[model samples]
Target: MMRLERGSSRLYAMMLILAVVVLLADQLTKFWAVSTLSDSERIAVIPPLIHFRLLYNAGAAFSIGAGATWVFALAAAAAVIGILYTARRLASTGWALVLGVLLGGAVSHLGDRLFREPGFARGHVVDFIDYGPFVGNVADIALTCGCAAMLLLSLRGVPLAKTPEEETA
Candidate 1:
């Protein structure tokens, strides 16, 4: 287990808050889509650009592995566990925010897989927000942005945890 430094509570607080907010936004939007939108009809938000088209995807982007919902569920569960484990050593606020977003996306997707239609661990993810060739939900957006930011941070050499000497400086 990693030991937390002084003021680490603030980092945890930020992470938790961001995660909850993202989760709520993703779920609420999906709820609204299910309640108001139709799988057979599309609502145009921007002609030929963006729109809302309800879809239950049983696979990853582009509907890859359409027959393997359980596999995706397992992957999402693993991602959630991994993020939580890494969060224990977080020292940078940016990393905290990014991980929180990633966690929220992963958890929301996992919830859908565990509770939505079809069956447990075989449920399809609720996807909307059509973008010409793609359709996905807020959780997907969060995950994409979080991953991009994480890559940027890593490229910049941001440490996940502060060293003992750095803590004293």
Candidate 2:
């Protein structure tokens, strides 16, 4: 087995911590949504703005490809795998945080898709937070924030440890 370097441990810890936080927040909020809100019911937090509206989505955002729930589940699984595969190389705190959020959101939604309702891999995601026509859960927000962070990090030249060849040059 390959031993992890000391600094890499920091990356692992940051990723795991953020991932767990997002997972718990997403799942707990989803539980609250299912228990409290009636299907398609909206409770306005701010009129004409934010609201809590329960919904079950069997597809990706905006119900796109509504019949492809299984595809999305697989996609989420792939994301989890990819993050784990690359996480060890994350040297910067910013990179670790960004990837952590992405990993967490992916795992949270994957849980719902795998175990919620309508059977495995076909289960719908419980979403309640509504911003006008757009409705989503904590996972979606985390994913969005993670993506935005990636953009910023990239623009700022997200660090890449020098390869042996580059180091020699």
Candidate 3:
């Protein structure tokens, strides 16, 4: 059984806050895109590199499995569950933030899958940030950054938590 440290509550609260902030930002940006942009419109914010182009993605990243809406939904659900489990074990603020961002991103995309175009579970995710040949949303950015943070932490050998033996080492 894993026992949480005395300071874990504060970290957990921070994580929850981070998750909510990411969710709100993602939803707000997507809502704006959906309400303001036409399906065929592309607004360039940075020439040759970035643009705000509304895209309805029914698949996972990069448009792979383009028509597999249910598959993507399931994957997002699994990611949320995994994040929840990992969040409880997180011993550092960095891990908490990363998990929160990841969870928020998953939830944001899942919300679109349940409530956006088409119908529940078959709805498409609204993507607007277009850079190069790839189009993504705020949620995708959060997830990507969170994954990178996790990778960096792992490479630095940041102690997630000490094992029982290691605690005594």
Candidate 2 clashing pairs?
none
Give the per-residue lDDT of model 2 (tens digit) for 111-163: 99999889999999988999987999999999999999999998999773324
Report the alpha-carbon TM-score of model 2 versus the true structure. 0.93
* Residue 80, candidate 2: C-alpha displacement in angstroms: 0.3
lDDT by candidate, in order shown? 0.91, 0.87, 0.85
lDDT (10s digit) by residue, model 1, range 6-110: 666678678888999999999999999999997799988999899999999999999999899999999999999998777766788998999999999999999
Q: For model 3, which pairs clash?
A: none
Clashes of each: 0, 0, 0
lDDT of 3 by residue, 1-169 (tens): 6455456656667788898999999999999999999999989898989999999998888888878898888888998887776665457888788888988999999898888779888889999999988999999999999999989999998866435554334
TM-scores, one per candidate? 0.93, 0.93, 0.90
Question: Candidate 1: which stretches are off by over 4 Å?
Answer: 1-3, 163-169
Q: Which residues of candidate 2, in runs, are more than 4 Å off?
A: 160-169
* Ranked by TM-score, top first: 1, 2, 3
